[model samples]
Target: MGERPVRRSDELVELLERYAKEDGTRETEIPGLRFIRASRITEPVHSVYEPSLCVVAQGSKEVLLGEERYQYDPASYLTASVYLPITGQIMEASPDAPYLSVQLQLDMNQILEVIQAAEQAGKPKHESGRGLVVSRLGDSLLEAVLRLVRLLDTPEDIPVLAAGFIREIIYRVLQDEQNAAMKQFALLGSRAQRIAKVIERMNREFAQPLKVEELAEEARMSASSLYSYFREVTGMSPIQYQKQLRLQEARRLLLSEGLGAADAAYQVGYESPSHFSREYTRKFGLPPGRDLQRLRETLGR
Candidate 1:
């Protein structure tokens, strides 16, 4: 009898574990590819998810965007159409079988190239949709992802072969039945793309007070329409979205710059230190000082 084929997900776990023994996210030799490994379940981590395709080889994860909750495992793949601030937690993991996953970041141009080349170029365009998508994994996609990872073992081939693999991955993702969201993010002047433009501006000017009317003008939508489509795409109101950015930046400042609570709050646009402490505690489950202390101790930094 012929030898039974190894499951793609199984081989994926072995490859990731061999390359990423450390229990943290690491960039790979292949550009735009990343490996994440963790031996145990971790606390909810507040961060931004950029445009990328994420495949979990082992364990499960829960991602919270606003009130929406998305969970996925090896059977499903997750893709982000645009940047979103979210809270993610590992729901299933252990030392004996750590959570292993690979992420390939997507560029807007690559997705546009696929959409233009494929038969979908003539499809009727839609305006807005959610930014995050979790869908069943197809065998072809799994095979393409595995080949991309396999390239790490042969560095010389990467110079010539990596681009084709990455292109194939993007092409497969765009070909999926539920890929409207991806299109909205890539097509010029799409409502979701317009909202994404507003989001980019917000990320750059998060420390300043939000001016919704100005943003609406930039997106070329009425203020009320912008509110509706923004919520549809981002799962949060514009105010809530800016708050997440502010809080995440404040956390970054406190840890990286050793800024005091008041200093960090002011820098991140909070008017009152007491208010900042309360809000930070609500978002992070601890006050800034305690949270920073716990994080420092955890990292021994």
Candidate 2:
């Protein structure tokens, strides 16, 4: 028989929506990840994106990681090799066809294991590149993802079998054109890992005052070299990274904790409420108070 016809995009869309409605209507927790189906506009949000892979079966989304922008659709997939603060919005969704997608959270141990396997298989030397990348989907990668999504249909078998399949899914990604970039994330002593270490420190203590010299010491690099490597790895300076962390936290406090703008600023390490207001407005496209107001109204808080 001839090769089986590839599934049409419409069929993929249907499968995604079906799984989404089942898993999305109620928050479903998988062993190592969380899955949700969302359509409404979200708050200007910033949170550490653990090493994870996100596939959008329908709709479009934009993720702002520091100064860098990553967008994905059905034809592409997004991967984050390290935990980083990222701002995201569901840019395309509607009542007629709400956003349909699946996210698989990654464990560092699993990633490290994959790295070892790839190395043993004589995978090419991992290239030096950013910790995050968006690449056109490969047929093998897409098929593997489709299989992972289909597992949701047989929830009974998920607990026992999902882990193995998830491993395969990641394996397919490693074989993609951009797999080398991801492999660098696995190499413990590589520059990418060093930069990831620096990011972990910054994320852990975003509220504390920062000294470039101190960060440089932690990363075992000179101040100037630290700046250069950090920017090269993350596409933003250390200070800008921290600022996104601060602003994202402040927004969360305002919306979730019901804190006022001034109080939120103080709590997030802002010395001047006005400075916080200016920066918050600049990044989020609205002042703190107004942004929160719109968020509450949009999300019906």
Candidate 3:
């Protein structure tokens, strides 16, 4: 058989390894970009993935959004236009050839700004779809991504050029064949916009118990319609969304502050410590104390 077509992914992977820092840690200075290098695959961990795009230059990953699973590799890109609770695991990583990737955080204000500009330019109306999507990678998109990542080497130029590069990336995404999904984020009165508002509110007050009626009213949709649309966009119910927000915060408190189980639970809005322990175990596959202990051990290793 003829030799398989050579993939540029390997080249990009090598560049990332030379430039990227360790995985699972956010770089201090960058507000909207993160580079990761992981020695081994990670367990599914919970977090609220905000609007963003993730490109895997080297390895692959699987994300669980509610019951739905999304897998993306070098040949594809993943986008989320609203806040979502997700469990993500690196499916392709190792010590010799670690997983390398960059995450570009999305800014709603910037998205809106682009939307207005596009509308003024008479961009065609876009159809609606799920709030999250994975699209096959394209050469132009990859080139833009590479340029954005490469800018890190010249720190002084970053402040001046980063915003323009980000805009270029977002513009490239808007011009893609599958642009409709991302376009929904820019439409002010669109169903996606309403849902995004609710997502923002949920993130802001995640510890408080949420009321579906209140949320529906805020979204200006009937309760049933809100339920259907929210699930259609986010793949989870309102209550489930709030629960995830709560759990993620509790985990953060436990891991970062070294808070005890009861204190962490109470701080995260759980009324009964026993109930918190049970739910935490169910969600993370271990009770708080043991789960944290295991995390510490893993870090040590």
Query: Cα-based RMSD of the predictions, in order?
Result: 2.2, 3.2, 3.0
lDDT string, candidate 3, 171-205, tens digits: 87877766566676666777778888988898898
* Model 2 Cα shift for residue 264 (angstroms): 1.5
TM-score of each: 0.94, 0.86, 0.89
Candidate 2: Cα lDDT at 75: 76
Stretches of candidate 3 off by over 4 Å are 1-11, 26-30, 120-128
Return the clash pairs for model 1, or none. Answer: none
Per-residue CA lDDT of model 2 for 26-106, tens digit only, reads 344356544456665444456768788887777888888776788897778888887777877787777776777767777
Evaluate model 1: give its lDDT.
0.89
**Best-fitting candidate, scored by TM-score:** 1
Task: Give the deviation of candidate 3 from the true structure as CA RMSD.
Answer: 3.0
Where does the lowest 10-residue lDDT sum fall in candidate 1? 1-10
Alpha-carbon lDDT, every model? 0.89, 0.75, 0.80
Candidate 1 lDDT by residue in tens digits, 1-301: 1122247778899999999998999999998999999999998898999989999999999999999999998889999988899999999999999998999999988888888877555445555778988998888898899999999999999999999999899988887867767877787887777888898888888999999999999999899999999998889999999899999999999999999999999999999999999999999889999999998997789
Best by lDDT: 1
TM-score of 3: 0.89
